[model samples]
Target chain A: MTALLEVDDLTVGFERDGTRSAAVRGVSFEVAAGERVGIVGESGSGKSVTAQAVMRLLPLSAEVGGAVRFAGDDVLGYDAKRLAGWRGSDIAMVFQDPMSSLNPLLRIGTQLTEGLRRHRGLSKPAAREEAARLLRTVGIADAERRLRDYPHSFSGGMRQRVCIAIAAACTPKLIIADEPTTALDVTVQAQVLDLMDELTDRHGTATVLISHDLGVVSSFCDRILIMYAGRVVEAGPADDIIARPAHPYTRALLDSIPRLHGELPRRLPAIPGSPPFGTVPADRCSFADRCPRVQDVCRTNDPALEPTATGRPAACFFPLDSVPVEVR
Target chain B: MSRFLLRRLPQALIVLFGVVTLAFLMTHVVPGDPARLIAGPNASAATVASIHHELGLDRSLGYQYWTYLRQAVQGDLGTSYALQGTSVASAIGHALPVSAAVAVLGVLWEVLLGVPIGIIAAYRPRGLLDRATTFGSLIGLSAPPFWLGLLLLYALAYKSSVFPLSGYSNPYINYLILPSFTLGLGGAAWYARLTRTNMLEALRSPYVQTARAKGMPESVILLRHCLRNVLSPLLTMLGMDLGYFLGGVVVIESVFGLPGVGKLTFDAIGTLDIPMITGAVLFAALFIVVMNLLVDLAYAAIDPRVRR
Candidate 1:
């Protein structure tokens, strides 16, 4: 079956100091219908840019090149009017910072019902009822009474729930929840994630869960894509990647995440250097300088995604499978 | 609304008090004696003293201030010293409508012409219209109002015979157009520059981008979203500009031989008409306070965030 959304060889670049540089280079992925996919990356790893490009929400100056097919429709060439019809209706998006994303001036009911009335041709009374139902679905109590309140009247978690309610208003085929719980308290974050998981499943909507927390993705996503330096360095079933990460960068990231039960004497492992700014250099492994196992060839030749002995892809010459059977 | 007025009422009283005190004291301290000016250059000493006594000018300064403040509160500005039996209040009443008419018409032109030009300039920066407005505003800002008024009178009124060179017409049936245009043109240029700069700054705000992302129509975004946000600062500029307009109109009214408050003030100063001078200052101060109050209320209404 065709995937719900397919982004092929996507590249997003910015013009800096009179030269064009890519922020996301040659990243490819797909989320099939009914499947949940997670993109795990730190800041400047191009995950958010890729997501924004799919929505055509980037600033006018940024240059993007790719094929983004949403339900067999090419999104790149659609004009403003057609694009507007797609956003918040066919492919609703919940933004990272729920605090600033919703307009403070508008009432919660107005925002949730606006897209429904525009896209679904629902009457005011019907739309208001649907909005209240959606709010309740997202676990917001007193949903009907709270509909008339503005965003400022809500707490941070409540506001994020309002955003989720708005996103799910149109019953979109896909919901891109970008770090939806990143800004909340730890307890609230877990509750929000659980609420979203339950709600999206009930609605039968495919979701692209973009987050940097591997634990969050492992608990929520069916598959995971580990991105680094504007490229997806490793991707596989979430269980397999967590059990045995193929890419050196992915392994380093996993080791860096602190655990609750284990008490290691030494501090967590650190990735030696940060991602390259603006764009990756033309002909070098992006992680060469930071990789402990870097070789002379790693500096001169860039690596492409190569399949491993395990059922996954890793972009390194020395795959984890070749490291040895017992040296983990 | 009541809260807003409560704050503004005290402000109005303070402004009126300060202007009345300063005007009364300054006019009294001037070199010319009002009695001699009102009577004649050759008046006897006894006649001058009696004139002072009769007018209550011989009273102590504090008593004079108290009496003036009380009478002003009752809307009874005392009779003019220059024109016996004619009250200062009546002279102000006659002069106010003309000055006010010119000011009202001038402000209309300023807002109508200025705001659109500012919007256009902001919408198309570095374009021909932007450059033209920038240059025009520079010229308008530097050119003295009195000189510009004379230039207009000379060129349009005299050389081309297109407008009246002097004299103001009551009811202004067929001939008031020229004076209104002259008074308003410079102010329009001033407001246009302010609006352009303010709008450009507002357009750079993140909310404007959010509005665009919502796929709102450009016209709706510009008028409803951008313009309203830009208006907060623009309203402040408008209030101060009104004061500048009033000040500038004084010279414009004088140059054109118009019988507005500027003319009356000038005549009062020449004849040392202390009562009329104080009345004019108090009127102007009250006028400014009322305009600023309206602007404050408007700011609160447009953006409730301001009220908070």
Candidate 2:
């Protein structure tokens, strides 16, 4: 069956002072209907940019070259009118910063009901009723009266919930949540993640969860894609990848997650160097400089994503062994 | 809201008192004498003295100020020495509506023209329309009001007869058109630049991006979402501009020959009409105070965070 969403050879670049540098380079992925996919990466991994590009929400200066197909239809070819109609109704997005994602000047009800009225074409009363229902579905108590309150009246977690409700209000086919709980407290973060997982599951909606927290992604997503320097360095089912990270970068990422059960080590094993700044050479591996198992050929030849012994795709000349590497 | 106003009223009164006292002292220190001007340059010393006595100008400065303050509280601004039998309040009353009409119309012109141009400029930065508006507003900001007024009067009034040359007339809008345009052009330029900067900032804000991500039309995003956020700063600019327009339209009023408060104040200053000047100064101070209060109230209304 055709995937619900297919992104092929996606590349996003920004031009400044006559120099064009790609942020997301030749990235490809797919999500089946009702599937949960997580794009995991550190900061500047182009994960958020990829989400924005799929939605066609990037600024005009961004040069996007790729085919983004939703339900076998081309999204990149849509004009402004069609794009407006396609967004929010067919696909919706939830942003990272809940504080800024919601308009401060608007009341919670107005913000919620606006998309419903416009996309769903519901009457005012009906839309408002649906808004209250969505709020309740997101676990906000007193949803009706709370709708009249502005965003400032809500706590950080509650505000993120409100944002999620807005995203879920129209029952879109796909939802792109970019670090939805990154700005919330740890306790609140788990609650919000639970709410999202439950609601999206109930709705049978496909989700693309972009986050820096591998634990959060693994807990909720069916499959995961690891990104480094704007490229998808690894992709596989969540269980297999978490069990045995095929790419060295992915292994590094998995190792970096602090364990609560283990005896405390002298120091945490951080990745040796910072993520490559700006753009890496077009013909070379982005993570070669930091790769612990780097070989001479890895520096000269850019690796294409190839199936590993475990049947997962990893863009590495030397895939790491399946055996878990011991932490020092 | 009522509590906010109640708290603000006494502060407003204090400001008004300070303004009036300063006007009183400054006008007193000036070399011009109202009695001498009223009696005439040819009048004898006795005539001038008698005129001064009648007007209580010969009294000690403190006594005069005390008596003036007492009478002022009772809504009596004394009488205009330059215009016999005309109360300072009455002279102001006659001129006020004319000045207010010009100022209001000027602000209307500024908002209606300036805000949209600014929004458009910001929406398409560095485009043709943006470049044109930026350049146009620069000229508007640089040109003096009187010079701009005369240029408009010459071209639109004298040359084309599209409008009357000068003076208030029936359907006073015709007379106000040129003067108000001149008065508002500079302010409009200011608003346009401010709105453009604010619009650009608002458009970049995360909430605006959220609105865009919602699949709302660009116009709706710009108007409803972006513009509402832009109002707080815009209202602040309007408040300051309104204060200046109310009492600072002397050049525009004189150029247009409109009997507005500004023109009345201008005439009072020339002839050293102390009562009329004092009355006009107090009127302006009161108007500005009230306007600022309304702006504060408007802020609370637009932004709920400030409601408390």
Candidate 3:
């Protein structure tokens, strides 16, 4: 069966000062129907850009190449009119920063029902009913009354739930939630994630959850794709990848997460260098500078994402066979 | 909202009082005697003194101020020294509508022309239209109002005859076009620049990006999402601009020969009509204060956060 969404060798670049720098370079992934896929990376790792590219929501200055197919139809080829129709119905996106995701001037009912009326061809009254129902599904109590209130009236977590409700309003085939819980408090973040997971599952909608938090992704996603310097450095089943991160960068990212039950370390392990800025050379590994096990070949030549001995894809000459002791 | 107004009213009254007191003092302190000017430049000393005594100008400044305040409280702004038999209040009442009409029409032109240009320019920064608006606004900002009025009068009124050369017409609007346009052009340019800056900022806001992400059309996002956020600042500029328009009507009214309060004040200043000057300034201050209050109320209406 064809995947629900297929992103093949997607690349996104932006031109500044007459020089084009690739923000998302040659990243590829797929999501089957109802599958939960997470793209995990730190800030400026191009995971958010990839999600935006999949939705074709990037600014006009961004140059996108490669194919993004939704249900075997090329999403990248859609014109403005087709894209508009394709967007909220076929695929919807939940953005980071819930405070800003919803329009402050509009009432929650207006915002929630807008897409339903436009995409579902529901009447105003029917759309309001559906919007209230959707809000209820997202765990907002007194949904009917709350719909009349503005976004400013809601807490950060509640606002993110409203955003999710809007995204799931039409039961889109795919939902791209970029750092959906990043702006929420730690306690609120779990509730939002749980609500999102439940809603996506109930609606049978495929989800692409993008986050820099491995713990968040590992608990929620079925599959995980680790991005580094705009490229997918590792991809496998979430359980296997989390259990044993194949790429050094992925392992380092996993290591950076604070532990609760382990013997206390003097300080958390950190990746030695910051993420690359501006354009990185196409011939070399972008993370070579930060990699602890950097080899001559890692710097001299780029590593292609090929299946390792354990049957998971990783873009490194020497993939880690087991979880490192320092990280554990 | 009513509570907000009640709280603000006292402050507004204090400001108005300051304006009145300052106008009264400054007109008195200026080295021009209204009685001497009324008597004539070559008047004898006896004639000047008699005129001063008749006009109550011979009284102490404090006594004159007290009497003026008392009469002003009783709806009497005294009589215009320059225009015989014309009460300052009645003259102001007659001239105010003309000035108000010009200012209202000028502000209309400012919003109608400025906002669209600003939106178009901000929608596509560095495009041809943006560059054109930038250049046009530069000229509008730099050009003197009188010179611009004369140029428009020559081009459209005198030469082309599309509009009347000068003076108020029966319907009034016909004569208002050139002068208000000249008055509005500078403000339009200012509005355009301000709107452009505000719009560009609004468009870049994360909410706008979210609007786009919701699959809203560019027009819907620009108009509904961005424009409403831009309105708070735009309303502020509009209110302040209205004050400027009222005060600035002097140049436009003189150029067009319109019998507005602005022209009345100009003529009063030349003739050293202290009561007329004070009355007009007081009226202008009150108008501006009220406008600013209305703008704050409008801001609260548009942005719910402000209501808190």
Candidate 4:
């Protein structure tokens, strides 16, 4: 069956000072209907850029080379009208910073009802009622009175709830939430995630959840894509990937995550080097410098992601546990 | 609102006092003598002394300052020294509407022409219109008001006869056009630059991106999301420009030969009308202070975040 969203060899580069620097190198993924896929990556992993590329929301200066097919339609090639119709109704997004994501000057109701009125062709009163209903679905009380309030009037958690409500307003086929819970408090984070899960469950919508937290993706997503330095280093079923990470970087990530029932460590374990500024250099394994199990061959050969003996795609030449695969 | 006003009342009074004090000091300490100018050159010493006593110039400096502040507050600006029997208030009252009309029309032209240009330039940065607006604003900002006024009068009024040459008209707006444009062109440059910069920033804000992702058209994103954010600063500039302009369009009024507060003060200064000069100064200062207060109040009304 055709996937709901197929991103094939998606590449994104930003132009600066008359030169192009790749932010998201060739990356591919797919989201089937009613499936939840989590993309796990640290900063500059190009995960956020991937989401933006799919939405066609990047700045004009960005050079994106990829095929993003949304339900058999060419999302990248859509004209202005078709693109507008696709963005909020067919595929919506929840941003990282809820405080900035909502317009300060507009009423919450106006922000919520805009998509409904525009995409669904619902009348004003009908849209208003739908907006109120959506707010209620997101666990916000007194939706009627709160509709008139500006964003400043809402608290941080409430603002995030409002953002979630807006994303789910049109009941889009796919929802791409980029680190939606990172900005919220720990307690609020679980609630927001649960709310998102509930909304997608009720609507039977596919979801692409992006985060830097491995635990977040592992607990929530059916399939997990572990991205590092603008490339998906490892991708497989959430359980198998978490149980035995194929790539050395994923192994390091799993080790870094603190356990609730283990011997308490004096300090949290941290990876030694920072991620490369833009895209990792093309000649060698991107994570070789930071990899704990680095071999001399890793420095000379670039690794392409290919399915392993264990039947999972991993980019490293010498993946974890299994024997080394011969490089061409 | 009441709280805001209460907070501002003392500030207003202090500003008014400072303005009155400055006017009094400048008028008293300046080289020219009001009594000497009022009395004829051929008049005897006795006549000049009597004129000084009548005008309260004979009183102690402190007493005179006290009387000046008191009288100003009670709507009593002393009789003019130049036009003998003309009250300073009535003279100003007569000339104020002309300057005000020019100011209103001039600012109208400014917002009408400047804001849209700013928006268009910002909508497509590095476009031809943006380059033209940048060059135009630099010229407008640098051009001397008198030179521009004279140029307009010479070109549009004198040379082409599109407008009447140097006179007030019956409906008033027709003759006011050349002078108003002269005033507006300079201010329009400022507003355009201010709006363009602010609009550019607002357009780049995350809210604009959010609006775009909502499936709304570019027009809606630009207007409803970006422009509304730019409005507060634009309105602030508008209020301030309006206040300063309303205080007096001195050079424009003079070039057009319209009798305005600026012209009245110019005539009063040349004739050494001390009371008239002081009255005009106080009026101008008061207008600025009041307009600033109104703007602060209006800002809260529009931008709710400020209230927090």
Candidate 5:
């Protein structure tokens, strides 16, 4: 089957003091129609930058280069009018903070119906009806009654659901949910994730779920891309990668997660060094300074994602074939 | 709504009462003898005493204050000691419309010019527009209004001869242009800077970013969602400045020869027209209190979180 969203050799860089700082360096990935893809990374891993590049929302000074073919269209050069049409209609986003995602002065009904009426050309009354339905579909009880309420009146989880409802209003082909559940409580995160999973599946919409949580990514996403220092270190089927991680960073991350039934004396493992932020794009592999298995060659030559025998691709020269069962 | 008003109304009343009381007593104590100023120096001692008794100036300060307060409450306001045969309220009533008209026109011009300039400056920061507005606001804030009024009068009214130098006119005839604009232009500059600062602050807020992410046009994001958030602070500034505008219009009105309450009050102070001075002060105080109340209500409307 053809890929729904194909990004090839994407690069995003910011200019500061006449020097170029590559925030996201050459990366490639694809999400098949009706599939869920998770991009896992730490704060400065450039995961969010990659998602923003897909939306063409980066600041004008930050140079972006790549082929982003969405539904057989090259979206890199879309003009203002075209970009307006693409957003909330072709590919929408649910941001990290729900409180900020919705305008405080607007009622839920107006915000939800705005996208529907703009893209779908529904009348006000019809849009209002559909908005209420959409709200209910996102698990908001008494959706009609709550339509007139402003964003400030809603709780965090409820606001997130409203954001999801807005993103799903037009049934876009793709939804880029950037850290959608990061600001929520653990219980609320689970609930919102479940609601998103159910709704996206119902609509058969492809999704890019960017998060730092290994458990959520593994459980909710069909595919996972493990990122480190502005580059994707590994990518594969969610179950294969989680159960049998091939990259060292992936293994370290999985080791760091605390299991629910772990023994009392168990110590959580953490990667020793912090990731880099301001560096120019060159031939050197970015993770070399932090990687424990670094060699002289690893510091000089950049590594590209290469297919391994374990049904995935990893950027490291040596890919693990297996992991210990207990660790897995 | 009721809860907020319930709390604010009492506070407003107390402030108004204090303002009237202070204005009445302070004008009397400011080393001015209204009786002497009124009767003139050539009058005999008995004539001066008769004039003092006739004007109730011979009464005790406490009795005078009590009588003035009672008359003021009943809308008498006494007669203007400077202008014979005219009540203080009537003189004020005649001048009120002109002052109110200038103020309204001035405020309208300020909002119309200030808000847009502020928005443009904020939208394109560090650009040519931003730099221009910043320079203009600096000049406006630093240049004394009286001095600027004269400069504008000389340049636009005298040199260029585009507008008249002074006085009120039939608004429909458009003769009030130069003086109204002179009064307005400086305040507009200040308002523009205030609005720009607030707008810039609101634009940086994450909600504006979120609005863009939601596929709303930049115009909608800036005007509808962001402008409302910024207006709460801007409105407060507008209210306070409006109050100042009432008391401070004296020099501008005098330079322009506009017959406003400020000009009347200024003359009253010079001649020690006690009744007229007290009336003008109380009126100015009421204007400020009323405006502050309106601003509080506006604040409640703009930010729902503030409403009771």
Candidate 6:
């Protein structure tokens, strides 16, 4: 199967004063045409940075080294003019904060028609017509009037719906949604996720979903890449990873999700320690201190991602072979 | 909108009242007596005393204030002491337009020059153009208007003869240019600094990122999305400049030899003309308040969140 997006050995770092700290370290992943790939991680685990590197949206001062090839063309190497053309037409993003993502000064119609006119070459009337249809497709009623309204007039969930509508406006080949429903209510979250799923299915558009919630990613994405300490710790089919998590970090993450049927503990289970912030020494495992299965080898050596007994790749000195019946 | 204006009216009147009262008390408390000045230093004590009583300067201070306020509301400011029976109202009326011309042109130059320069400077901060503007604005801000006026007049008019020396004549705008430039230079520097700060903030906003993601060009993103946000604050500053501009600047007017309200007030103070000074100060204060009202209205018009 051919991949629509291939990100290989991507490293992103920011420099403050004279010291450089790697935000993302040697991460590699791919999304096949029409594939749904999930990258789940805690804060500062570099999921968002990886996405930004793929888009070439990192600041000019950021020290980036890697290859981001979208549709067999090197994205990182594209010049200013070509980069402008490539974005929003071939790929788009749905950011976390819908409140801040839309321009406060602009009417919704202007914001919507901008892309339509730019990418689709639609005239004003045609773009307006297309924008209204786009709004309606995202389940917004009274599209014509709503388009005239400013973003602040809409509720948080409604604004996110507008954001999704914008992302799917041109029907790009891949949409990188970075925690699209994080700031929404649970009910609205489900609706938004469902709407995204429906739209992508209809267009056969590939997706890269970034989230911290394992439950959200597991339900929406076909494949899961669990990240910790700026590196992908485990990756496999979603169902397999949920059924038998090989990496100890992944196992802890699975244990953290609350379940409805189980005898509830007084306190929810949590990972023992936080993820290392940046640039962990290459000699030792990044997750060594936090791992319940840590040993002398884990302290001494950083394990490379390799295929384990579960038939998926996991980067851990001691991969968990035992299955937890209570987790499911 | 009408309701908003109606509410602001009383507040403006209160400010005018306070300012006029202060001017009246100040002119009264000072050593110079309008009666003595008008009669001359050589005049006898009897003649000066009669002149003081005739001009109603001998009346109690509170009574004079009350009378002036009453007549001012009716647009009746008494004769100008310096101009010898020329009504203060008519004198101020004649002088108002000169100030207006300078102000309008000053603001025009500020918007035309300051806004674009600021936007460009902000685009690449600490670059060559930005560094130049920073140094230039410092000079603009520090140089007194009178000094800047003299320097420009000397360089452009006296030395190169690029512009006519001075005075409002047939080629009216030609006369207005030097004074207007003098007036605008400082404000333009101010506007540039303000625009730079606001534009930088708007550029970093998420909306700009969203615009870039939409495949729009950098020009479109800067002008359409970011510039629109920068304009709100810029509009406020412009309104204030226009308000104060209409009042006429004392230093700019004297240096350029234009007969603006500033000159009228300066002459009034020199001759100890209490009526004219009070009238001019009140006029300027009223203008500022009105401009502030217009700014608030413009604010509501541009920002939808403020409308409700």
Question: Model 2, residue B137: what's the lDDT?
Answer: 97
TM-score of each: 0.85, 0.95, 0.96, 0.97, 0.92, 0.97
Better of 4 and 6 by lDDT: 6
Give the worst 10-residue stretch by lDDT in candidate 4 chain B. B32-41
Could you tell which candidate, 2 or 4, scores higher by DockQ? Answer: 4
At residue A306, candidate 2 shows an lDDT of: 96
Q: For residues A1-328, write the lDDT of model 1, one tens digit per residue.
A: 9999999999999997898888899999999987899999888898989888888878677899989999989999888788877876778777777777766555688777777787798999999999999888888889889998777778889988888887777788898888888988887999889888987898788999999888899889999999988999899999888888888888878878886565663887777778787757969898898887788998999889989877699888766763332112
lDDT of 2 by residue, B1-308 (tens): 88998899999999989998998898899897888888899999999999989999999999999999999999999898788899999888888888888888899889988999999999899899999999999999999999999999999999999999888879888998888889888988988988999999998888876777788988988898989898899898787678767864889999988989988989888889999999999988888888899899899999999997
What TM-score does chain B alone reach in each candidate, compared with the true chain B? Answer: 0.92, 0.97, 0.97, 0.97, 0.94, 0.97
Which clashing pairs does model 6 show? none
- Top candidate on lDDT is 2
Interface RMSD of each: 3.2, 0.8, 1.2, 0.9, 1.5, 0.8
Please say which candidate is ahead in TM-score: 1 or 3. Answer: 3
lDDT of 3: 0.89
- Higher-TM-score candidate among 2 and 5? 2
Which sequence of candidate numbers ranks them by DockQ, best first?
Answer: 4, 6, 2, 3, 5, 1
Where model 2 places Cα greater than 4 Å from the true spot, the runs are A325-328
Sliding window of 10 residues with minimal summed lDDT for model 5 chain A = A319-328
**Clashing residue pair totals per candidate (backbone < 3 A):** 0, 0, 0, 0, 1, 0
**Lowest-scoring 10 consecutive residues by lDDT in candidate 4 chain A?**
A319-328
| Candidate 6 CAPRI-style tier | medium
Write model 3 residue lDDT over B94-151, tens digit each, in one string. Answer: 9888888888889988889899999999989999999999999999999999999999
Taking the tens digit of each residue's C-alpha lDDT, what string does model 3 give over A1-328? 6799999999999999999899999999999999999999888999999998988888889999999999999989988888888888888899999998788998999888878988889999999999999999988999999989999999999999999998888889899999999998999998999998888888898999999999899999999999999999999999888777789998888888899777867899988879986698999999999999999998899999999865799999999876434433
Runs off by more than 4 Å, candidate 4: A322-328, B40-42
Off by over 4 Å in 5: A16-20, A262-265, A280-285, A288-303, A308-311, A317-321, A324-328, B44-67, B70-76, B139-144, B147-165, B169-173, B246-248
Candidate 6 residue spans exceeding 4 A from truth: A322-327
Candidate 6 residue-wise lDDT at B139: 90
